[model samples]
Target: MNNKNKRLVIPLLGAPGVKLTDTTLKENLSDPFVQFKTLYKIVERFNPDGIFPFMDLTVEAEALGLKIEFPENDNPSVREHPVKNRDALNEIKRKWKGVSERMITFIKVCEMMAKEFNILKGGYVIGPFTLAGELVGVNDLGINVIEDPDFVEEVVDFTTSVIFEYAKALLETGIDMIAVLEPTAVILSPQQFREFSMKHFKHLSSELKKPVIYHICGNTKHLIEDMGKSGAWGLSLDSAVDLKWASEIVPSDVRLIGNLDPVKVFLQGNPEMIYEKTKELLEKMRDVDNFILSSGCDIPLGTPLENIDAFMQAAKSFK
Candidate 1:
């Protein structure tokens, strides 16, 4: 973490590397060599202060035996949610082995990045509630949260255990930080988020030795206080959040990592638009030393390279 007045720029910009290289999204995820090459090209192009490999929420679910669809052009997605009841949950847990081969593929990528890049390197894991949503269908997970809160806890507990095994492998690769992606938690009320999502993260943060960045998609203003209390080193929020407001709510010691609109400002806007947007965000958080300049979420594939360039230049030029 940059403790000085200078803010760090760590955009979540991995998928676009496929456009720069001769690889597809599916290939980059499965083949370590291809994945490394794609990300290497991204680093060579932007040269950010820190980098994380592609953000894949399906890795753990697919590793746990759930079917997944890996698109050639886009991110992989869970194809089926099999855990409908306690018996199904028990069945999956009973058959559960350790992390799968593709899981190792990502860990290998981390190792390559750690040995290759001198700057801060990070890894990601699907957060407990999100993984639970994958196993038990998101619709069912939502209903269960209210109707069968106990069952939801049981499922989340299992998912948390699964994440522990995968996260340990990532940590062993010498990465500097881990971002727990909990996009599904956005639908829950603040109290529900604390009970179902935040507690498990507390346990997770206590166990992992590295800094944990609690990343949740969409507007998380309602849940920011609980998110701040999850023992994570930082909060990577989405474009909908007001980062300046978040900085005031979260503790001064915790780093604040984003709020830039990845789509409207980076993917859709031109270079000048991006520069101004990035400059505006930088200006708002100027007095906050713990702020890190970044996109609200992973910069979507096909975003113009010049847009990214503008973002970096704006951050670098800021005092």
Candidate 2:
């Protein structure tokens, strides 16, 4: 699609009111029918150009035998790092079953969304580096990347294999696009990002039949150019990024999809405030033809529907 003329507003709205609440995530995610109904409700309420099925980053880790704790109000989070040593990592790789793992339920949801929803259907996978962090613990992974570069590479390589298989399955389900969430890569320098994350991302992007949107939270000012080199069709940025600066540096072909503060603007603001903020952002990015107005990241739980409505209205009214 020509994003230049379309003005797409594809905010990440996987919070309680729009999608499934925490109470429903465990019960609903496992059941395709319930997941479809939940996703349909989100599509109906938001009327977005696309539907982003459950943004839980823990799905990949959980599939690798890591334990996850589902909180009452928040997204599920990984509770353990099963691959603590080389032996453990090798064991995981040996036993890894892509389609039959815990993530199968999520793949089924994507299939349901693709077949049932008329709008663009999108699926998400935690980026390989990020999934590696879940498996080995972020702190340990960081230290190991410097103290034991070989070990880090091996772990990330295994994760790349896991993500590739999982992404391939999602694509087979007919989703229009896939989003790779690489929040862990935000801590790496540009060169480190290229070596550890971008390479694997390029592999995924090249292999996937559908377009890939790469997202990294926090300030990506240093990595914008490198991020464009990852072969993704679009780059989803966080609120810490300056869209104008990013637009200037990143290649024009890579569509830019964010920077709106999900918490301050969507969760706390009133409709009028939300509309004004939306208009402000629209004006800031007006010159960037490939820009798609979106929340910097997933809209948090309890964000007001009226605020979201105002955001859409402002985008629609922008001349």
Candidate 3:
């Protein structure tokens, strides 16, 4: 999407940074020093066309006062859903100051990455529906969507405001792109996705005026049409999607950035196998110019470094 390279190679890389730097996920996430070191090591080793910080979805939710549990090795998870009603959400809004320290830590890391790296630097923000799910719990949100549509709209609107502010902070650091993590919206029907997620995504992408990469995990083939209309410059899809098939449906200008199975191709397979799989994907997409080869999602922790090398080599060597 950046157009700096004919075939850009940027995996949704994060947890692997911890594994590469010999630091725990908690340490790298909390301290910008640890965060920068991990990312810098990744760039040095992999030489990716673009680089992004750890894709921790909990940053925005935790900042909004949700209970979060952080494990040493694994990514953090939201533990408490305190907003049971409209009044509860209003209370949190009334007391809101700004983003928390961890959010600032990520922004600071972006600043550091901006100063040090010449390649494209990216930032992450949790999508509106996903953050709302964290606040009210996914089950209640789903039920309210059908039974109480107005309430669901109000909650989503509030979450969008919160995300907009956070996105502005990330953009201030001079990052090239922001990927909105909207994994929760994967379960919604196409119409529901357009109504709830697409509307707010358009707002963020338009207001920021930066290349927004819409990233949703799992099989997103059902929602491709709405996602293409969300004003995103690119779509970062998961392994379940067929990139060759999606390339036909997605808009001509929008770049496609994934499909390689992170676990199967990068983690479980050896280098030779990884090379063949990466090459296979490359061959399928050779006719499409707006394509960036990447892992379907974030490369899992404990993935072998050599396998990553094979993926990069395959992309670079392809005609």
Local distance difference test values of all predictions, in order:
0.91, 0.84, 0.89
TM-score of every candidate relative to the true structure: 0.98, 0.95, 0.97
Pairwise lDDT winner, candidates 1 and 2: 1
Model 3, global lDDT: 0.89
Name the Cα RMSD for model 3. Answer: 1.2
Best by TM-score: 1
TM-score of 3: 0.97
Between candidates 1 and 3, which one is better according to lDDT? 1
- Residue pairs with backbone atoms closer than 3 Å in model 2 (clashes): none
For TM-score, candidate 1 versus 2, the one ahead is: 1
lDDT of 2 by residue, 90-111 (tens): 8988877765655788888888
Clashes of each: 0, 0, 0
Off by over 4 Å in 3: 1-5
